[model samples]
Target: MSTRAITGDQWVVLRVPISGEGVTAEVAAFAARRQLRYDLGDDGTLRITDPESARVIVTVRWKTLPPQVPRTLGFQLPSAAAVDVLIDPGPGLAAGRIAAALHDALSGRALAYTDGELEGIRAAMPLLERYSAARPAFDNWALIFRDHYLEHSTGFVLAMERAGIPAEWIFALDKGDRTWNRERVHATFQARGYRSDVLDNTAVNLPHAHGDELARVGADIDAFLDAAHTAGRRVLVVDDGGLLARGYGAIGAPRTADAALELTVSGIKRIAAAGPLAIPVLNLARSQVKSRLGYREIADSCMRRLQALLPDRKLIGRQVLLLGYGTLGSRLAAQLRGLGCRVVVVDSDLPALIDAAESGFTTYRTAGQALAATSPFIVVGTTGERALSDADLDLLPDGLVLAPFATRDFCALTENAVHRGGASDIPGVGMRFALDRGRRVTLLGNGRSMNLFEADSIPNEGYDAYRAGTFIAAASLCADPGRVPAGLHTAPADDAIAEAGLWSAYYDLYAAQGKGAVRPPTVPAPRLADLPAPVPF
Candidate 1:
């Protein structure tokens, strides 16, 4: 059925095939929830009018009679009056693809929706491609992402190559176990029809590397940057923190060379004074941490999985001492509380402590007091700083578990303890550090980021947001490096919105395929009395 050109305004019609009875209701519900006005026809036609300035009309038409009919979604462009998009709702269509198509049809315009409405559309549709008529230029640019055996970084590299961007990868291999291999990573990239040049630096992986080894790695990065500069290629470095930040400093001040860095918090602080244009992908924008597909999801999922590893230590109905009430800490607290664990949050920041208290969690100004009071079954550090002082360790109860949500720095205080014959290997629990001779405290992942060390890989939904941030960073740098200042920057508003939509769509698709659950945990709200009273200053 053809949609008649309604008089007075142009329309962008989206015609989708209806295979069953519920399709129309689903579409109507989606439109209503989005606050989009629609006109329904008895002949199985629905017209959706965009309230924005574009005046685009989306039409959904049934190709077959009544139920079990195939449907088509078509979009009519207002800018290009003659252009129209007709997409067949093929068998096994994914919600993400549909959303991508719609977003693409709207010319990448942001759509305002109520909370959960985006997820609703994502669940209803699942997968669609955002069709771009013109691929952006990246001829003079090259991308370098830190490969950590996750699909997101590799996926981003593949995507950049697909967009005609020259891309390479860098892998900080675990020298002890060779956790990441250059040959394996290259082979994986080769399978996708791309040649990979990975800077496999073992020194970067060694958190405790010192002396000549660290200096050698620094020189290696300096040379790499110099080569890219001499070649006149704009280098976009992802995962520009930790060891990589040290390398950036070794290269001296940022020259007039074409080099841009996308960094985490630590990286930004290290290189900010050097005057290199940096996009702070990890924390600058609240969206990066607060979004549905954020680190919290990964942290929560990983923490819950710890139950199987340490079956004897029951996570449910146990007290958890959380050090540092940052994004990761707060999210993990809520998830643990959902599983019936009493969560006590400790943070030096008064505001963070207050926030935790307000969120119905017991808050403490010092780790020692929290540990002594709670006698927690598990202690998690999320502050990215040394969470446990030597004094605090002395206060920890025997048989307690210590897990770091951040990198190893958060647990640095335990290093000396481990070296002084304080840690002993537990049968199934790995190393258990003894603080006061007899008090055995199990250290998870040797005080590394438990989520990264324990989880096989970050969930694809969370990684999708990471990939989006990387893409935006690279694209922004490529578009005009000079336009981006030397200071830190957040993902552009439009890119953030587009990425959020993509993230929801991908999450819904993953759920439809039984990959994993992307929905946030549903927990009973905590009562104020259930938590300890806030410590007075």
Candidate 2:
């Protein structure tokens, strides 16, 4: 029997021992089979682009050296027949599948791992294993609503089941999901005993859609609740908060969740805006584990994606204006500074600004002040709220590139009446708009989280510990829904997460283990104000 291995969101790099011509033909066949397009650059770089989105899904580079030259390209030059296959990083098994096809076509030695090495190279989930051993019996059925089709998400659901949480039904919003994540989710659920629904028109501003779209999502939730109730099992909502915000507050609705775990800060805000909640809601967004540990990974992804999207622009010694000094923003500022970029931060919150200043970043009270003083080449928005107003767009430097880590950061520009109509699409990149006096500013993504815009932002292993924390919190909340009161609970969730011994598991699993294994320093993260802002319009 082949060994099953655990993995994360990553790109697969395969080196094939075939001639350049042979590999190129195989790649062409691969693209033609999928109805994809390809571009062969002058520098022996072959790119496979998606037909619909115009995004590069795969890249192939050839390595060749003369017979007389003794220089090796990192390995023994076996007659110069090696071409590196770079499968784009995504959320599903598609990359692996593509790699397998190419490997087989070229009759090359094993370079694809997931499909090739079905056994070995798998990392064990220590925290999940420990929690599963405890046998936290969750009697009720669960309405698992999260980003669907992600490999890690599938792993998360499987982990939940392993930890004794029964998922009655699964729901995923039909937006911003990677193609493979959707395919993997559908295939996984179909094979398993659970029914999953990809709710259309529920990705953003749900229940507020007024017509068919709203009705469809509402009916789906109603059906899930009814089924769980008929089975004499209370429904526990494991959400990113979209479904909970949409259905949990329906007046005279069929039923409500017994307990809920809200994941993202956006979800927490949505749940609050939708009126009073009557069930115990564990605030995983504000938990110490997520805020302190998870945000760092998220920030890292943001920076990585920014660099990937703008491959030609040099990051070192660049002038950057960073909007928002919250958890994600602060971390991004520090990282940008570390990369030798002169990073200036802006925030409405006084304490956050003070913290940024003390952290050695140039800080400002508002974005306008920062814009007036510095002409930045890149403007990064980490504020989950509106970072730039429509009028403020005029003040931006000519040829400025806006990289939004949050969805609503550049909404003012993207949604502006004039700019929206006049904007031109820069395929593979984002939208480019002409501002006043011939100044041009480009949005690096579709005004969504740039890191997640057609890209897997964080690695699966990078966030495994936090996912474990969420699971621990969910298990605790679902085990006894009434143990805590019916409001957003953060500290208690953090307590439960801390007790799960995730740090130890993480250290053992990821960090180097030796005689002198140094434990990370315990520094309490600065508390951000819990004041709720209105959901981005």
Candidate 3:
């Protein structure tokens, strides 16, 4: 749908269908990127003001449609909603394309502009494209977990569709995302002729309701697998540990995928706890491409989210304690030092502690020791396991902030906080638990990866190589499942991704000077709580 500006003497209005995702954050981020001043009100209304004069330049208004009438231009709207962008007709505002740019941003549709104008618009907001449009043949169907807001992930799914393999279904389980519209991805997929619907399992929280949500998602997957089996098409599972851990085993029905690809280290741990698998499982979690390249971006995002959460706090010259000196933790420790902070690193592994000590950081064997030695204002947790024990909770400094890169790192406080004073929510910042002796600690995120807590931390360009590598691995595995035995395999997928010349593609796209490495537009990092939440469906 092409969105045109309805012009008047004072304001120009741009109307577009809303997908019930986080539209307010998208608009606020748009304003922040352009260095434009924007304000969000309590009633879900947004106003963009002039930076110099502080006068209102634009007003974003939202309109809701009744359930009886939900179709627009023959497309089903996720929520009965639409948004109107009211812009000022002032010169130098690029008034003609502001509405169109926002329209394309909110709704992933083609803009009604000339070729030259289209090029400019693309430069303003570049979408992810397949590294190579080579249509490889694949036999099995796919069920993948993806954050639809990320364009690179969306591109990965589209690339699979372009290949012979069909996406039977896609999953979006992140309930805390606030920047991009996952529903837009859902609508875009439907519009592009893909028969996949985003299975939203976001309503399920972790720890307490983990099994409940997993069972719900597993049932859906079981049904999909059954349909695929009846159609004589074996399904390939691309899991992020959410399914393979417990839910995949709970399926009482005789439904299983032909092959599976595990994505994260946490996922690998979950799979290990779940015991050996029946089908061939490829491990992309241990791939060199991801370890050598992707972890850096992940660490960068972690720090970015931390900084966004503490915008007013100064990091320079302050002592900071970091748990786990693994791939992500090591990188985050370095980043913390680079920010001029006194970094204290803790690791259960002796070699890791020695490595941190050799790297000129204050190393400790546990969080208790680190807390006892240094009075850090911020304590970062990267260990996937429990970083702080129940006894260690007694050592927490007053008003110390805890930033968890993994979910279970600070589970001691989040999952079970035992103190005479109790815990309370800090609004945009996470929960603040009162400790004994009048000391308290604040959790930066909801006991999950801080980078993924209501924020699009990693840039599409930053993670392009890893996603492409995953695609290469998936295509190669599906083409010949016999290559990997009926067990979890890592070397085969790593070799395949390496043999596919992914590093060359990545270098050419990002590192090599004068190559087609185009830096995508910078995504604005903001506190998501301040942005408008989507209207519930």
Candidate 4:
């Protein structure tokens, strides 16, 4: 084989000899089989060039190959004949080695391979290896963002661009409204010379088409993914929860999973179970403590809205039923108590109920007992799951208020009742849903997230922490995947500390710009005192 280096380029030109009889015909046949383009010289020399820089060559004499050259490429060639397969390491030596190792292992390598060799191969596939080697991780990365308004999404793209990574945005407009400033997002992408696409929530339910209306939208998503794959770009899906996951799963799981990296706020549990590296950037317990403040924001917002809508009904001295004593529930409970409301906590999870009990609050294993006893003036559901069933709705007192702090599903029963003329709002109270037969119940934000719907958005200070933590997590993942195990991993401790510093800097920056700044409250570290004492089931 003859080799020569090209100046200022990582690529090199190499010639591998095919010495057997009918060498030209054999090489031509192999190239044709591999769908490789080639040309035959007048001297009968067969030459093949890769459209991209990568090329692979294989021959029977593996031992004769250069020591610096990788052996994994040789394993891919047909063993039946002596053939020279030339491969160009377009992504540089490190990526080439990693890709070759993965391909080699996936293509049925010998079982005799030692653990040390496997570890060495895995270590080569770190997220930043390609970037560090002067090769792009992919031609471009597709960023599937749940909220375009969130600074995190925009900031992430900006950071990646600064690092010399080409990225595009795919925004999920869940409500299909122009309120999200579509024009502004488009203008930003255009000014930055990046491509972007918008998809609505309907795409989540695939194969069940909504006639011609949503067909084009579905086609858009498909075309976007196809273009990314064709261009050899990787996809990084940053979603709030199940929307993108379900959409991707609906389209085709294997192919989508192969090309995308999913970072979710709420769906990491499900995604991690499927054997992919699902980074939890937004989980309440794992990533950042900012969500605790978000919960407080939602609670405070809901209380203020309630007061404005019904000035006669005060939250102080009211009996409140709180469901799901998780991160949101616990924080909201504390806030409600501080506001002079007596909070009764209920959760199906025994440990959660016990924790609430241990926290010096009244606890109930079921909503029935709490409802019957309290006849609560206000009911707040913080569990991500459906907290109120039809039966639970029937048990509610005539004049009561319902608020879902976690997700919109908590208000499903109220929504259904309202549609059926079983619920209606009091005349003077805004967002107060009253039931038929003179029964009145106020449903806050119609069961949607109070923080988003009532509070307008997450507090800027909390959002800063969330975004900073996410930035550090993404960068850390890229720099070293070996440090992160293949499962749902907590945000790095360093990221949490960095998040605080980042938030402080952000506050100072805001102040310097003459904008009033609100520094996030220092969240006390979680204490084990809230843990439930062991009680044999």
> Better model by lDDT, 2 or 3?
2
Best by lDDT: 2
What clash count does candidate 4 reach? Answer: 16
How do the predictions measure up, each by TM-score? Answer: 0.61, 0.71, 0.70, 0.56
Q: What tens digits encode model 3's per-residue C-alpha lDDT throughout 1-537?
A: 445643435354555544323567777887787788878888867776678987655566665534433221112223334555444433344543454455556555321122232222222212123332444436545554534345455556655665556544433333234434345545555565544433322332254555565566567667766777788776666766655664452234255577788878877877777676777888888888889988999999998889999999999999999999999999999999999999999999999899999999998888888888789999899988888999898888798999988767888776673641377877767777887788878888677777876665676557767777777777778778887887778898888876776665556545677645643333231222332221110
Ranked candidates, highest lDDT first = 2, 3, 1, 4
Q: Lowest summed-lDDT stretch of 10 residues in model 3?
A: 528-537
lDDT of each: 0.50, 0.66, 0.65, 0.48
- For candidate 1, the 10 contiguous residues with the lowest summed lDDT are 70-79
Prediction-by-prediction clash tally: 29, 1, 0, 16
What is candidate 4's local distance difference test score?
0.48
Q: Give the TM-score of candidate 1.
A: 0.61
lDDT of 1 by residue, 151-212 (tens): 34444555566555543423232212122222333445544444334332234434365547
**Whole-model alpha-carbon lDDT for candidate 3:** 0.65
Q: For model 4, how does the per-residue alpha-carbon lDDT over 296-318 read when each residue is reduced to its tens digit?
A: 54456555555554567778888
